[model samples]
Target: MSGENQAKGNAQSSKKANCCQLTVDEVGLLKLKLTILAVLCVILGAFLVAFQVLSFMRVENAETERMLIEQKNRNDDLTKENTKLKTGLQETERMLIEQKNRNDDLTNEITKLKNELQGGKCADGWQYFDGSCYHFSTDTKNWTESRDACVTMGGHLVIINSQQELDFLNARREMGDGRSQRDFHWIGLTDAEEEGEWRWVDNTPLTDPKLVQPKHTVLTFVSAQYNSHSTQFHWFWGINQPDNYKEWGPQDCAMIFAGKLYDETCRSLKRICETKSCMAGV
Candidate 1:
């Protein structure tokens, strides 16, 4: 019985030692599993943080892109406006140049007109019209003596060229220098060289004898009336003028009295002279 009891106790002690070893191994395995799980949790958390940062970065990039597009559109609008302004400026410059040119042309035209007006002036102490010069004298002389006086003064007796000249002389007669009532002026006309034939001092024959001579057979005559409104002289001669009537003896020379032409004796009378004329500045 004592030998049996010792053997049994030894067996029981071996069993208890085996049980403790098994318990220690199980505890070490549990510790290793916990450490691995902790490491895996840390790795998962790092991945989640990285994902969130990536999403934020994407949002920032999208906002930046939108701003860039808006800036580009504004730049485009500014460029178009600049182009339009440049075109307008060019047009305005062209119009200003045209206006300046027009002003210069008008100035030149006015200057030319003034020069023409000043160039055609007549000389002093002489009346000028249609390129001719005239001089009226107060002294009295016979027709022949009057012509000689005009020749000495570098001129000739007055020659009635056109009716306009006749009107001009009539206007002078009306202005009478205090001697119009009885004053008569010797003109360059006479029928002295040939009987009933009138001629000027320059020997130009009378083409229109009605202006100076009248027939004796005519019962009535017409006289000239000056029409101020028309600036012309209309003829309605006096009754039976220039009839070469027997009472007026041997009338050869012509003279003017009160703006009327008359055949008169070559007696003393005022003389009118004419000369070749030149414009002052021409």
Candidate 2:
């Protein structure tokens, strides 16, 4: 019985020893598996962080490219505006130059006109009156011959326009040294084209018949003194003159005697009166 009991105890001790060895092996294997799992978790976390960083960089690059494109567009617009301004400025400069040239031409024209107005003159031995020159011929000739003579002197027969001009001619005639008050001088008036339609040498018709009245009253002083009696004289015509007198072969010309006008033969000899515009001086 005692030996059997000892064998059973030894057998139990061997079984217990085997069981402890198995437990140790199992714990060691568990520790190795934990270590491997920890290393794998660290590698996975590192990969996730790298992926996030790459995504952020891509977003920043996209934003920078967009800004660069916008800046390029703005620069192009400014260049176009600058080109337009330069063209407009050039056009304005051209207009200013043209205006300056026109102003210079106008100034030159004004200066020439001023010089002409100040330098107007007339020939010597010609009387200047009313912006015209007059020449009274001393030689006697027919009406046609007198007119030709006036044309040779660069003038035409005198044309009386106003009462003041007639008065001036009368005063000049009274002041003549050897002129008679009754002396008849050939005038520019004529009716050769049509009877009773008097016209001047300039082709201007007589519009006022009062200028050639047959008679008029004149007030004159009898003595040379200032306190002399005033006398009246009658200006008369030669017996119904300008009656188309056939006796002298159709008198169609006009003459001036004193301050009166008369019709006479065109062939009659008379002094001439010529008139022309004043000449411009150099």
Candidate 3:
């Protein structure tokens, strides 16, 4: 009986030993499964991190694009502004040049006028057209005599159409408080043999014009003097006094108090010596 009891205890010990071994095996398997789970979690976490990084990169790229676009727009705007400023500067330069040219022209004109205004007494009359001086004598002579005198002086008896034209002939006569009126002026109009029928030596018809008409109208008269003159027929003659002003001499014709021609009577009348250039413009 003691032997059988000893064998039973041994078997029990063996069974206990086997059960501990199984427990150890089970613990090892559990540890292996936990390790696997940890590894998987690390892999998934790495994938998430990579995905987040990619997403951030995409966002950064989009922002960069937007910034690039904005920069391009700003560059375009600046370029346009620069071009506009350049164009404006060019226009300003052009205007300045034009203004300078105008100023120069005005200065030249002023100088010329100052010089012309500083001439002699008869120089003022000559300046009427060609900047010449014409002197009209207050002496009386017959028409033929006056014409011959004008020829002798390289001039001729005066004709009138406009006051400026008359200025060429009469030299802007103002009568000077009626002192010059006591003297006479030689005019181009003459009756000669006819009454009220006047003719010019130039063969131009006798016409008395008013001033400054419209497009399709008759010749107009404009007086250069300050006084208001009666709108009367003005006659003129070309200078032949060696191309000088028409002066009168008594030897040209017979003397007369009054005759067939009133306007023709060069008995101390206003006269002029004119050039063709002066006649064409006015």
> Of the candidates shown, which would achieve the greatest TM-score relative to the real structure?
1
lDDT string for model 1 (1-282, tens) is 999999999999999999999999999998888888888888888988988988998999989999989999989998999888989889988998898899889888988875555444434545665567777888889999999998888788888877678778767755656766467888988889996788889999866533643444333223223222122323322234444444656778887766667777888888888876766334
lDDT by residue (1-282, candidate 3, tens digit) is: 999999999999999999999999999999999999999999999999999999999999999999999999999999999999999999999999999999999999998876655443233334344433344555546566767676666555554456465553333444342534334455554545453344566656555533211222222356444124333533222211111112542222111111111222234444444333233332
Q: Which of candidates 1 and 3 reaches a greater TM-score?
A: 1
Best by lDDT: 1
Query: TM-score of every model?
Result: 0.48, 0.45, 0.36
Candidate 3 residue spans exceeding 4 A from truth: 1-127, 130-196, 201-282
Residue 39 lDDT in candidate 2: 83
List clashing residue pairs in candidate 1. Answer: 221-237, 222-236, 222-237, 222-238, 223-236, 223-237
Each candidate: RMSD: 16.0, 19.4, 13.3
lDDT of 2 by residue, 1-282 (tens): 999999999999999999999999999998888888888788778877877887788788888888888988888888898898889889888998999999999999998886555345556656655656666656678888877877788887777776666666666655565776766678788889998777888888876543443322232345554232222322222334455666967778877777666678887555546555555323
Quantify how close model 3 is to the true structure by its C-alpha RMSD in Å.
Answer: 13.3
Candidate 3: lDDT over CA atoms?
A: 0.53
Which is the winner by lDDT between candidate 2 and candidate 3? 2
